[model samples]
Target: MDMRETPGVTPPHPAPDVFGHVGYQLKRAHAALRAAMDQALRAHGLTVPQYSCLEVLAARPGMSNADLARATFVSRQSMNVVLRGLQDAGLLTRPATVETGRARPATLTGEGRRRLRAAQEAVYAIEARLVRAVHEDRLPALLADLDRMARALSD
Candidate 1:
């Protein structure tokens, strides 16, 4: 068979939107949503990563930098950058842990909680709007599908 003359093979169709392809669409949508979220977080003086750190620390108040990196899916080096920024902002403090003299555990300052409360509202508002973009009944299925996709991708 000529390389170009396979009978069962079909030529690719033209597409207008980059997102017309499944992978492209998913990537584009992710970029769009993340950009929106980052902008929202900016208004509260937080970056998405910082907000994420705040949330995880809020939930588990004594996570070491390494533990925080694991929970937030970030590199320890990058986590240090964010942790330093938040600490400098007086939003959090990462002191040597009482349990482990070598590791630093993050504790949210009162200011961190205040900022987190506002950021949480904005984050949920973004979710509410994005969720409402789809049909109400489809939202649950969409979430399940997204969760499955994330799990598959992680694995």
Candidate 2:
């Protein structure tokens, strides 16, 4: 049987162009958010990756460099540079030598925590601005949908 002949059915619309594509919109949104985050973090002497590493380390201390890279959505090499800068600034610490394997766990120092807290206030304000753009009743649902989308893509 032809599916087009089925009752009470309609065909989906084709994507109009780049402007109409959901992927394009998502990319645009990511770029905008990244820019906002970068600007906000800069005031605290932090880049986005640096802030991300500090944030994650605060939450889950002693994570390996590779794990931090994955959590921050950056290449391992890129994360190494971020880690080096943070380490140089005395914002974070790792063992001088790995005790066992090549993976040296990292942790935020007291200074790192202080900087992360300051950065969080700025970042949260930026996030609040975005949340306020959506209706109050729909905000939770919108956040959930975003989480779902991220999970889907990551998997």
Candidate 3:
């Protein structure tokens, strides 16, 4: 006899099919975006994390390593290595010593801004392609929905 057919029994909801699940779709989109970014950034000699760090620092100068790591979605340790590399490349600078706190603020040098500007052209082109894939009228709604979904899960 079917459990649902029994008067005293209750059946649990069936799991969603993986292929049609929202999470699966999101993962596929993310993978495609990552691959595209990787290829585009390669010509500029920048990794996704490195590019992200530069972008964030440009808008908010003097961000500490921890804050930059969080903004770039990388670990603190990984951000340290990235900072060191940028420092060596003359793309950014940090004080030799900190008197008040252990957190060292990072600022992009002139070369860093130039590099970021070049990379931004490639990144923005990719973003434009993505935006074109969606309907013009529905783009705003789609962005809002995506933000809402992220906030729901984060909360």
Candidate 4:
């Protein structure tokens, strides 16, 4: 089956030579990598977002719900879902937010820290493999380029 020129079923459109198209390809690549990372995290009973929240909380303890949502680039509703799951698992606790009485701060418990450590190790192992697959000389420039692309698209 020729995917690029599929038949009567209506083929997918090819990306034009444009920045948006290029960014889409980059995003697709990142999504694939994230899927692999998620698989790696599964053994620790952590989803990708859960692990991300743990990472963020570990680094910035007592982060407000909104701040965590922004840090993880998710909506507050989504953050609540993930936080709820983690809380149910006895991994984290939500306390009153200092800045906003209406919001709560998310903090990792000892159990969450332990699981996060294991998950972080798992993620690093997979990430190391992925990094090794990249060309050595291109890594720095590629990261810088990705940062620029992300900033441009986000703004």
Candidate with better TM-score, 1 vs 2: 2
**Model 2 per-residue lDDT tens digits across residues 72-109:** 99999999999999999999999989868999899999
Angstrom error at residue 152, model 4: 0.8
lDDT of 3 at 11: 34
Candidate 4 residue-wise lDDT, 1-155, digit = tens:
75444366432345533443665677777898888987888899998888889999999998877898899888999999999999999999986345647778788999999999989888988788878988999999988998897898789
| Model 1, runs deviating above 4 Å | 1-18, 97-101
Best by lDDT: 3
lDDT score for residue 148 of model 4? 92
* lDDT, candidates in the order shown: 0.87, 0.89, 0.91, 0.84
Best by TM-score: 3
Instruction: Please provide TM-scores, in order, for all candidate models, with all chains considered together.
Output: 0.79, 0.86, 0.87, 0.80
Error of 4 at 41 (Å): 1.6
Clashes of 4: 0
* Candidates in descending lDDT order: 3, 2, 1, 4
Worst 10 residues of 2 by lDDT: 9-18
- Which regions in candidate 3 have their CA more than 4 angstroms from the true location? 1-16
Residue 85 error, candidate 1, Å = 0.8
